[model samples]
Target: MKKLDYQYALKPDWQSDARLEKQTTDNQSNIVNLTLSDNTGFAELNPEQYTWLLSFTYQSTHKKKSGSVCVILENNEQNTVNHRQYFEAGETGTRYLNLSGLLADYQTLSQWQLVYDHCLLMPDATLLGFKKPDIHHGPILIIAPHADDAELAAYGVYSDFSDQVWITTINAGQNVQSLDRQYITGLDDNLKDAVSRKAKIRAWNSMTTPLLAGVKFERLSSLGYFNLTKNTFYNASEKQQNDSVCPELTPAISRALNTMTLPNDESNISSGKRLVDDLASLLDQIKPTSVFVTDPEIDPHPKHIMSAHALALAIQQSGHIPDRVFMYVNHLRKIKKFPYGPEHARTALPPWYESTSKFGHYSCYSHQLTLKTQKEKVVSFDSMHDLRSKPRIQKMLKAWWHKKVLKSGYQFYGYHHYFQTHIKANEVFTFVDGKTFSDSLLQKE
Candidate 1:
């Protein structure tokens, strides 16, 4: 295949003036070294207090390749940290190498030794740092617009901080056709019955999956709103009763589907004072120091974007000031087949597009997972009924056709399902301080 160049529309410069430039080389030795001229202020930094990263922009050449690469960094004492990133044939973007595990302090890192496999590294590279997600600051809250989003994007964070983590899923009543397929054959052939059944299963899945991560069962809840129904709640008056999208389901399963009474059982679901009020109430009650929500700027899904907007409104309404907020993207706007390689591979930054913001301004944090934890994530996703159900015939056929005829692998089915795309060696998040998060959303509105 003759590869064509696919480059970012804007210059991928996080810090254009950063030192450490390298000349392009073809099949360069796996190892390279750079010596920092100035070590000022390096000793002042504390490794345990922050997660450090080395970032560089790169342009992939038009050549037939494995589409994956690894970078190994060696400090002055020969302590090394391994980083991996995948780029498509002829793809261009930036890569961030995680440097958190190196034992030496920054001051002792006067010399740099890196081992690279493929692709071209740009002349400029810079170092960045983000505050660690420490539970001692306060409890952590993770917000998901749909049932599986938390597992898909940040399972590692919640798993690691399970002792103090609270997960709340919004819009768990999505009427996906997979639910219909799974139940229609076994139950009375009514669409409403199938949808209702799905609501219960998904709601149950949302409330239970985190248990595997040692998260308290009492700490899990769902808003139970219908798919694409946030707008209805936002537009209606707080007292006005919005009709249930899935009326077949009981009040408990469809509690937040309408603005009437809500669920108060072990599984809490609500839409009181509209959806925003429900979220604000949770914020006020939990008093979380750190929060996680979908990134509105880069995630293309409508519900994901709306969920972030709702969170911003809730923050404004409650006057709760979280120390920090983590934003993740399950759906990058313009790219398809992202995280770009095999399931076992490491995921760096998502490829940037014309509209995507430049990287350096916001703190980028990569939550690296152990092999054991990755297996745990696989189990967590498997518990979600929607992901495990049989694929539609059309989807199966499309995936087969793509693999056999087009030679392009299927991302949503077969080998490349959630097991592949979502289960990566690292989960990357954009770290924005709570004040900045609130201010940015407000400005956008």
Candidate 2:
């Protein structure tokens, strides 16, 4: 008889460690089964002895109810394991083996054996063949309200899954300006022009760099809006000029002057139509298995809402909708008030359960953004501490911490709050196979 150098080490002492009383030779290979005593398990083994070690813990009451086994195979070198095959007990106390077909490759080897430190349960479980793992392949499209919206919303997802992402912005044109000379008296002509141009470039750069790190960035056409000049409306007369305008009017007009502001009705319709066309074209070209878009309900910005509508419409119009479509919310700022409520709570739509609900329900995939904490390092510490002054700073610090943490997950600006209501760390959307769409109608086989 030929001798092999392999050996077994039992853990917790096997109930019975009997070697095979007899070995049979069949098809140029050796076959042997070593019986084991009850309440015995095997210890960990090094790579030199066995190519792989499979361990399982069967239920005490139902011996085969809850146990798992797997083997690690050497890839390039005999002493190093690379690939693995696993078998686990299923819900009904039945054992299922994963990747059992690969065992055929080992059949040609002269020395192969099964070593169980514990007894085999009655009616030994049969091994099932293995199947290949699914591969994720598709273009992840991200739509944002502003130029930097997608970067702020899904940056982490983009970073983690690089080269598989594409981002599009609805409003991409430069802001308009009016002539107000109050603060420009001391500035030189060349300096002022340089300053203005540099500012615009900076804003554009800020939004593009992070996205370019791992995604394809595209700027969509802008909806026409009013312009501002010298901190005032382009058409505003001298009397209306001031260092500080009313709080409400300041932001609205400021954004408009900086970027074109579209007329409510026209911009909405135009943005919607354009988004639909752009998305449809991209879909037809990529034919992605899965698609991700912004949740229409949680999109407060008019542009975001309009863009989502257009995307939904485009998918409906296209003959082939993706196998799965997932929607993420960007502005989770409002989630502080209703952390446990449905996503619709933060949107303009009614709850999904309501009779008048307009927003559709989709699977919610939520994940926490990771953050690193620094150990205490005193640097010019201050002795004064006041309880009254801490609340405001604490609130601000909390918000800042939240933002920092979210970056670790999806690089989105508001993911933490957005994901609170959508409890799943990651949600999956699956389209009914062989389904088609036409005129927004779904055709199922």
lDDT of each: 0.64, 0.32
Weakest lDDT window of 10 consecutive positions for candidate 2: 373-382
- Quote the RMSD, in angstroms, for model 1: 5.9
Q: What TM-score, over all chains together, does every model reach?
A: 0.77, 0.37
Q: Model 1 over residues 45-75: C-alpha lDDT tens digits?
A: 5655666566666556556453444543442
The C-alpha stretches of model 1 lying farther than 4 A from their native spots are: 1-28, 62-67, 73-82, 102-112, 178-180, 183-188, 227-251, 254-273, 354-361, 389-416
Q: Per-residue lDDT for 1-445 in model 2, tens only?
A: 1111211111211122233322455523222443333212222221122211122222222233322222223332221111111122232222211222223333221132332111232223222111111214766555554544544344445555557665544443222232233123334244434334323433444344444454444422222221212122112312222222211111122123222222332322222333455456666655666555555444455555555555555676566566655455555433333222222111111112222113322222222222210000000001101001233566556656655753312121222333333221112121111122122222210
lDDT, residue 344, candidate 1: 49
Cα-lDDT of candidate 1: 0.64
By summed lDDT, the worst window of 10 consecutive residues in model 1 runs over 7-16
User: What TM-score number comes out for model 1?
Assistant: 0.77
